[model samples]
Target: MSDQEIPAREPSWQSRRLLSDRLDWNLLRTFLVIGEEKSISRAAARLFLTQSAVSQSLKRLEEQLECALILRRGPRFDLSPAGEEVLRLAEEIYGNVSRLAATAKNPQDDVVGKVRILTISQVQSDLYDDFLIQLHRDHPRVELEIEVMRSADIQSSLNQKTATIGLGLCRFPQTKLERRRLLRQRYAFFCGKRHRLFGQRRLPLEALQGENFVSFTSDQLGGNLSPLTMFRDQQGFTGKIVASSSSFEEIRRLIIAGYGVGCLPEHLVDIDLHNGLIWRLPPAEGVVDVDVFLMWNREQRMNHAETVFLDSFRRLLEAAGEE
Candidate 1:
C-alpha cells in the first residue's frame, strides 16, 4: 500500500508502554518552572540548570506531547491553549506528589515538604530574606514557594487554599480565617528636601493646608482613608492631592521629585531621612498606625512543618516588634 493510503493502526500494549516510559517527569517539572517564571533564563537560573538544558527540555516535552505548549511574545513567553491545559494538570499532579511525599516522610525525621506563602510585595522585599535564612537554618529540608502580590491577591490565595500562609496589613475581617496580629506599622508624613517644609523639624497641621499632597493606596489597607482622614477630620487641614499611586515606590519617587508631601512607612524612608533627602513632618494628632497580621485559613489542618514554620514566623515578628 502507498504510504498515504495505508490505514493508521492503534498502538499495541508494548508500544504504549514504551511511549509512557519515554515521558519524563523532570521535563514536566521544567515546563512548569518555565511557565511560572515566564522566562527561559530565569527558569534555568531558578532550577540551577543551564539555559541550554532548559531549552532542550522544553523542546523534548513539546515533542513528547506532539503539540506546541508555549508561544514566544516580544520579550516574554505565554502559554498556548494546550499549555494552559497542561499547566492545570501539572499543578494538580505536583500537588498530589507533594502530599504523597509529606505523608511518606518520617514523623521523627527533619521537617520537610513545601510551604507556599502569599505576602505583600513590600513586606517580601523587607522581610523575605531574613525569614528564608532563619527557615533554612532551622529546617534545611523544608522548601518554600513564595508569591509577592497585592494584599487582595494574598487574601484570595489564602481563602482558595492555593497558599499555606499569608502576611500583610489586615484592615478587614475575613470569615473562616484566623488572624494573628504581628505588629503595628507606623507611617510618617515626609517632604522632599527642596519642599517648603524641609527645614522645619515639625510643622503644625494648619501649615499643611493648601499644600499639594501625594497619596498611596494599598489593598491591604482596605478602605482606610488614612492621611486624608488624619488631615481633614483630626488636623482640620485641607490639601490638594497632586498624585496618587498603588505603589509605595511611586509615592516615594513623587515625593522626592517635590510633587507633594506624602506619607510613607517609616522603615521605607529611614535611609532617606538620615541622608536628608526627605524630612518628616510631625502631625499634631492622628498619626497613622496599621496593624500587620499573619493569617491562615481556619478550616485547613496544619501539618507539622507548617506549624513549625508558623511558630518561627511569629517569633521573628516578635523580635522585630511586629508581633
Candidate 2:
C-alpha cells in the first residue's frame, strides 16, 4: 500500500500502559494497620479516620480477598487465618513500595523542599545546632523544620512522611525505617549555684537520694518510658516524684531556682558546669545510658545534600562516642 493509503490502527489494551493498578491497594493498607494495632478503633485513630471507615475498609478487603480477615469482640479484634496470609502479602507490597519511593527521590537544587526532623530528647539539641549551621551553609535554599516530640510521634511522623528524620532515645518496631547510632548520651544530676551540692566537685547518688528531685516526663525524651520509669520499675520506689515538666528549659530553670536536683543532659549542663551555675552529682551504677539514634525513612532515597548531611552527622556522633 502507498504511504497516503495506509489504514489507521487502534491501540490495543496489551500495548496500553495503566498509570494505576486495578486492585484496591488502600484496602491492603487498612488491613495492615488493623493487623498491627489489633483494634479497629486504635487503627482508626492512627490512620486519622473514623471507626466506621476503618471497619468499612476491612469489610471491603475481606470481600475482595474472599476471606474473613478479622474477628471482632467487645473492644478487641483478632486476625483470622486468612488475615495472617493477607498480612504477609501486605507487608511484601509495602516493602516494595517503600523501596520504589526511596529510589525515586533525587536531589534537586531547584524547587526548595521542606524537611521536618523530629527530636526525641532535648539532649540532642546541642548537636542539632551545629548540624543546622552546616545544613544552612550547604543547602541555603532548603527549609529545615524540627519538632521535639515523643518517640511514638517521631515514628509516626517518619511513617506518615511528616518528618524526614528523627533523633531519639527509643526505638520502635517499624520494618520500613533505618537507624544510625549517633552517640550514647549520658545523664548528669544538676543542682543550682545556691544548692548545698554546688560547691562539691563530685557527689554520690546516695547523697541526693534524700533531696527533693526535679524530674522530666517521658514526653521530654520522646518515649512513654522515661529514665525515671526505670527507677520505679527496677527500684520499686513508691516515693512521690516532686517536680515534673516536659521542657528542658523549664527543667533547667527549676533546677536553677533550687527546686531540687534534676537529671540534665551532659551537653546542656556543660556551660553551666564551667560557670559553676550547676554542679554534677557523682556517677553511679544506676545511670541509664540514653542511646541517641538518627532515624530516617528507609523507603525514601537520600539525595546528594541529604546524604552529605547524614554522613556528616554520623561522623559527629562517632567522634562524640569516641570522646
Per-residue alpha-carbon lDDT of candidate 1 for residues 1-323, written as tens digits (9 for 90 to 100) = 31112232454767567866888988988887787677889999989999989988888877667667777666666787888888777755654454454444556667877777877656634564678787898788777787777566567656645567887755778997778775566777789987988879556767776678888665212353353454444555567778887777888889988998888878777899888899888773336777667888777655667778887887877787665
Q: Using alpha carbons, what is the TM-score of model 1? A: 0.61
- Residues 1-323, model 2: lDDT tens digits: 32111232443564334313545898888878787677878999989999889888877666555457766554565666667887877766674563343333335653244555788655445666787787787767655666787666677656654456787755445687777766676666678987888877656555665677778776234354466556533544343557887777888888888888777777667788798788777555435656667887777555444566666677876776632
RMSD of each: 8.0, 11.9
Q: Model 2 — which ten-residue stretch has the worst lDDT?
A: 1-10
Off by over 4 Å in 2: 1-20, 95-118, 121-123, 139-149, 152-165, 170-236, 240-289, 295-306, 319-323
Off-target runs (Cα >4 Å) in candidate 1 are 1-109, 124-134, 219-233, 284-286, 301-304, 311-323
Residue 207 in candidate 2, Cα distance off native in Å? 9.9
User: How accurate locally, in lDDT, is each candidate?
Assistant: 0.72, 0.66
**Clash pairs, model 1 backbone:** 182-322, 182-323, 183-322
| Model 2 TM-score on a 0 to 1 scale | 0.55
